[model samples]
Target: MRKPRDYDSELKALELKARQLKSRRQSQLGELVIATGADALTSEELAGALLAAVTTHDHAMKEAWRKRGAGFFSGGRPGAGDSAGREPGGAASGAGSTPPPSSEPGAA
Candidate 1:
């Protein structure tokens, strides 16, 4: 006869894997924020901007944003022509500043 499977252990393992994946995603997001210099924004500003992005229904705008994000990953930061993260008529913000220390333990 074949051995019986331990369903409870399998379920627990699956849940643990899900939690690990979620944790990794959150860490990557935090890294992305820092890498993009968005960490300079206050918590309220960041939250509001993220909310706006989430709620926006404009596909073209979303595509633009997506392309810009792809540039960040493929190239370095956005180019001089890119205006997404700049202040109006001003030099790029957060250009040469050090990012604040991360609160998470073991974060570099």
Candidate 2:
């Protein structure tokens, strides 16, 4: 038979779990901001940079996800332009590294 969990211990464990989740969120956001430093990469270039930093996903899948994500943000709205062709600066963006000028119809 399994031992019943004590209420006090259970509450403590729940609190610990919450703390862990919060810590993870904080680190993730920090990492995200830090990843893009300087670069003129298109959206795809940015994602490629981030993807290079982590050994999480297969190359093909990562590219596919990046493509899908860019589409989600731009949608079919007009003036999407080069944004449609690029991704944000992931791990490669740095100071002075700006994306190319947008190529939308009327983005002057």
Tens-digit lDDT track of model 1 for 24-100:
99999998877676766789988999999999999999999898788778876643335444645213334423323
Flag regions of model 2 displaced more than 4 Å: 1-4, 38-93, 96-108
Native-referenced Cα lDDT, model 1: 0.72
CA lDDT, every prediction? 0.72, 0.56
Candidate 2 lDDT score at position 26 = 95
Q: How displaced is residue 19 in candidate 2, in Å?
A: 0.5
- lDDT per residue as tens, model 2, 1-95: 99886999989999999999999999976654433332344668667767775865588877886775576456642232333347453223322
Which candidate wins on lDDT?
1
TM-score of each: 0.74, 0.36
Return the top candidate by TM-score. Answer: 1
Pairs clashing in candidate 2? Answer: 37-93, 37-94, 38-93, 38-94, 39-94, 42-87, 43-86, 43-87, 43-88, 44-87
